[model samples]
Target: MHESFRLRVVETKMSKMSKEMIHLLGNYGHIGFTFVAAIFIGMGGGIYLDQKVFDGRTAPWFTFIGLAFGIAAGFKSLFDIIKHQNKEFEDKD
Candidate 1:
């Protein structure tokens, strides 16, 4: 009976660890995707505006602005996620 209980406890711990690992990995994946998507979307919009609306008159200016906005957005999202995660950990503790 004692042996069985020990085995069960070990199994439970392993499962919990695996679940935590998966959750952490998912968060990382989400962070990466959010960052890249924001950058691409911003740059793409800028390119479209410069080309379609301004007819290339704006040239690289709009592109640069869009890129800067994208980078800022990405960093913001990253910080927000980190903050949220920290809050969650604190709450758990």
Candidate 2:
């Protein structure tokens, strides 16, 4: 009886922890999507400009610049999210 009770307690704790992890994963997914969207938008804009303004140059300078901008934007967004989460934790404490 005691062993079964202990097993039940452990299972309950595990389930609760798993739920929390799932919640955290959902938050991460949102952040990841934001980062990817920013990158794609930047790249798309660059490609459009390169084709229209640059006359489809082989160099792809605009594309490179756009990629850099996109990465920067993504990092900035990630940092902002982390900072906000940290603040929330601090507030909770």
Candidate 3:
């Protein structure tokens, strides 16, 4: 019984530590993921337009513009997410 009780205490401590680490890491990770995803989406959409828009008429131009727009849109979405998070924090405060 004593051994089991001691094990439980150790497990509880480890769980708390892990939870704190996750909280610390999660915020930074989310930001990094957002930036990477934005660039990827920009490049992907650009390539898609290069392939699908037309054949040599203006495909390359479309691809470049589409990619630029996609990146902008991605950043905008990230900004919105940050704003929402801030609002939540403010509400809590």
Find the candidate with the highest TM-score and give its number.
1
**Pairs with steric clashes in candidate 3:** none
Model 1 steric clash pairs:
none
TM-score of each: 0.79, 0.66, 0.61
Worst 10 residues of 1 by lDDT: 20-29
Stretches of candidate 1 off by over 4 Å are 1-14
How does candidate 2 fare on TM-score?
0.66
Q: Among all windows of ten consecutive residues in candidate 3, which has the lowest summed lDDT?
A: 20-29
- 1-93 per-residue lDDT for model 3 (tens digits): 999999999999998989657855665457767877887888777776677656456667866886687778778877877787688679879
A best-first ranking of the candidates according to their lDDT comes to 1, 2, 3
Q: What is the C-alpha lDDT profile of model 2 across 20-87, one tens digit per residue?
A: 68867866768979999989988887888899877898448888888889889999999988987788
List per-prediction Cα lDDT, in the order shown. 0.92, 0.85, 0.75
Give lDDT for model 2: 0.85
Give the better candidate number (1 or 2) by TM-score.
Answer: 1
